[model samples]
Target: MSMRVPGGGFDSTNPIRLDFPQSLAVYDDYAAAQKAVDFLSDNVFPVEQLVIVGTDLKRIERITGRLTTGRVALGGVLSGAWLGLLIGLVLSLFTTAEQSSLAIIVGTLLFGAVFGMIFALVGYAMTRGQRDFSSVTSVVATKYEVLVEHKVAAQARELLAGLPGGLPDPFA
Candidate 1:
């Protein structure tokens, strides 16, 4: 059985869902939730009847470094260079008798680097110092919950009972 995400423009099976899911266990970390599922799998509990859900979503951004003009320019140049290189290679693939592949590639690479650097710097400048630091951002769940199809919830819960420390459920 499958479901479609509303307005997600999807016309295929949705693997992120379970039918009549019941929370079998919840844990503070994904590992714990995964461990419970692993235990169920080990006990032959028809693992297909399970799903792991991350709850209490939180967005975190870890600052990597401070941004500078030179750094921005270099980053842009490298990015643009890569794009240019890709375009050049594609164009070179259909090179004619009068066309030189080496020239095409070199030209594209240089152009890409220059364009990338300029674009990067311009974008950074437009940000107007609002965001000056480089950082990586990610959304994480504060807790993970192991859920099972309603029909197999009991079986899964029973199997998880054998885990070394057993599963912990604050709500239970």
Candidate 2:
């Protein structure tokens, strides 16, 4: 006769954490994570069952889309300033008897620089301090985990075991 156990034989000591359930395979590079996903897919794993969670939200966003609005605005302001300077120079060249005056050139350059700075600052501030403004570095976290759907968790584990890396279980 089989002995009766409570909660369908699930040990209280093994209470599953719904937030982060399985294992983590930390790769030094994102390419590795992508390669792992590709390999799993090639082996008949459906894409829907796998999720690539970027540890860095900004990096993921950038990869999935074109330049952010701040970058775009900054670029536009810079380009517009340069164009304006060129137009001003041309106007001065035609209007002045000899050459563009130093005053005009300096004034235009100063105005352009100030405008560019203001636009950049405003664009950056619009992000509400969610991103870094001083640098263009593709910010990413040290670790990113590939979450598997609960239904295909066992298959994922099996496929991972067949791969080169061993998945390490992480805890809070």
Candidate 3:
């Protein structure tokens, strides 16, 4: 769906611009691609005409650690305690000066710890030893390409050529 920006130039309705876009430059990393665009913007070039597209996508997953019953219970306890402390603080805001907010916070913390431990233990047991490892996954791109409307591709290339090592080597 097309999002109406302040200026009606970008047609976000389509992933790729239907009005032919030509590659202005390609960089190994996104930062370099972004830098090129920023440079163009600083030079008063039509930034709206440019788009950075990531290609050669890859999904990487890093195994953090093996999960154990004790570890799970400890993690749950810590998270629950934090949540309980937040709730207690919010609730205590409505209490009168005669009521001790400390008592409420401490009571909630204890209850949270117990509830957390029980839930953690039960969840771990239900897992049946499946998915016992923790991991983080990310989708990354190998290359980032700067695309500009075909009409302004030449101007973009010329502007980019002024930047240090901005142009990709044709020999390599």
Candidate 4:
């Protein structure tokens, strides 16, 4: 089944299906593919008929640093303090002048810091050094492909040919 948009065109129910798509161009990066589409839009091409697909995906992990109890505790303290500060501020808004807003804020902050440190230490201890390092992971694509509906492929090609260095060598 196909879903209809306001303009009466069938909105693609499935993103993966290309609907008899033809490759307009392929680039090593997503930005280049986006730029090509933007150029098409500027030239009054039907941008809705285009799709950018990322292919050859790879997961990359970068080791940031070694994990330690002290670091964990510090992180916990900072995060907890921020949360406490936000809570305290909200509470302060509802409090009267006689309620001493400053005390409440400080009290919550101190409590949060202690709580955060304890939680962090407990979590670290539970891990038992099984995971000792911290790292950031990202999934990236090696290539981006510009796809157009088959009917408009020739027009897209003709327009892209006017762009300098926009079209890659088909034979290559």
Give residue 158's error in model 2 in angstroms. 0.5
Query: Candidate 2: where are CA atoms >4 Å away?
Result: 1-24, 56-80, 83-134, 166-172
lDDT of 2 at 77: 71
Between prediction 1 and prediction 3, which has the larger TM-score? 1
| Alpha-carbon TM-score of each model against the true structure | 0.86, 0.43, 0.82, 0.86
Tell me the tens digit of each residue's lDDT in model 4 across 1-172.
Answer: 7774442323568744546788899988998899889988999987777889999999999999999988999989998898888888888889987898998899888888888888988998999999888899999999899989887899999999888786976566
Global CA lDDT of candidate 2, please?
0.60
Residue 89 miss distance in model 4 (angstroms): 1.0
Which ranking of candidates, highest TM-score first? 4, 1, 3, 2
Looking at model 4, report the run of 10 residues with the lowest lDDT sum: 3-12
- Clashes within 3 Å, all models in order: 7, 0, 0, 0
> Candidate 1, which segments miss by more than 4 Å at Cα?
1-12, 169-172
**lDDT score, residue 90, model 2?**
65
Of the two candidates 3 and 4, the one with more favorable lDDT, higher being better, is 4
State the weakest 10-residue window (summed lDDT) of model 2. 2-11
- TM-score of model 4 (CA atoms): 0.86
Q: Residue 30 lDDT in model 1?
A: 91
Where is the poorest 10-residue window by lDDT in model 1? 2-11
Candidate 1 residues 1-172, lDDT tens each? 5445542222247765676888887899898788788787788777777778999999999999999999999999988988998999999999998999999999999989988987999999999999989999999999888877787777777778788987695665
> Which sequence of candidate numbers ranks them by lDDT, best first?
4, 3, 1, 2
